[model samples]
Target: MAKAYWVATYRSVTDPDKLAAYAKLSGPAINAAGGRILARGLPSQVYELGLEQRTVLIEFDSVEQARAAHDSSAYQEALALLEGGAERDIRIIEGI
Candidate 1:
């Protein structure tokens, strides 16, 4: 099976404190669920309609694993901490 990738792009961060709180929990939660963080940071350059915002890329063995990681209770808890703190778009894609 093809590998999967979790791509998260932040649109805007309204509350730094809340985001920070979520970050503290999310990393461990995701790591425990077999997700490996590949990259995370603001873009060095933006083109087209892209905004220079925080982005994260995580790799999982499969799409199912990626989905499981997102749906896990631990991750759900972290999600709660992120609610309203920022706007983000997250996608799970099959890797080549």
Candidate 2:
């Protein structure tokens, strides 16, 4: 099975406190679902796009694993914590 990559490009943050709260739950949530965070908050030099923000990348065994990881109860708990914490654009892409 092809590995799946989860990417989240952040735009803006509203509440730092909530972000902290979400962070507290993220690791356990992913690990429990067999997902491992490859890199997070890494800087990207985009000379083409001419803009940048925090980009988070995670790797999963498969698309099903990726989706399952994000849809799990623990992740949902984290999501609930981050409800208004930040503004983000998130997606899961299958890696070639």
**Each model's C-alpha lDDT?**
0.98, 0.86
Clashing pairs for model 1 are: none
Residues 48-88 of candidate 2: C-alpha lDDT, one tens digit per residue: 76447777888899999999999999999998998987999
- For every candidate, C-alpha RMSD to the true structure in Å: 0.8, 1.2
lDDT of 1 by residue, 1-96 (tens): 999999999999999999999999999999999999999999988899988889999999999999999999999999999999999999999999
TM-score of each: 0.96, 0.92
Q: What RMSD does model 1 have?
A: 0.8
Q: Among these predicted structures, which one has the highest lDDT? A: 1
C-alpha lDDT of candidate 2 relative to the true structure: 0.86
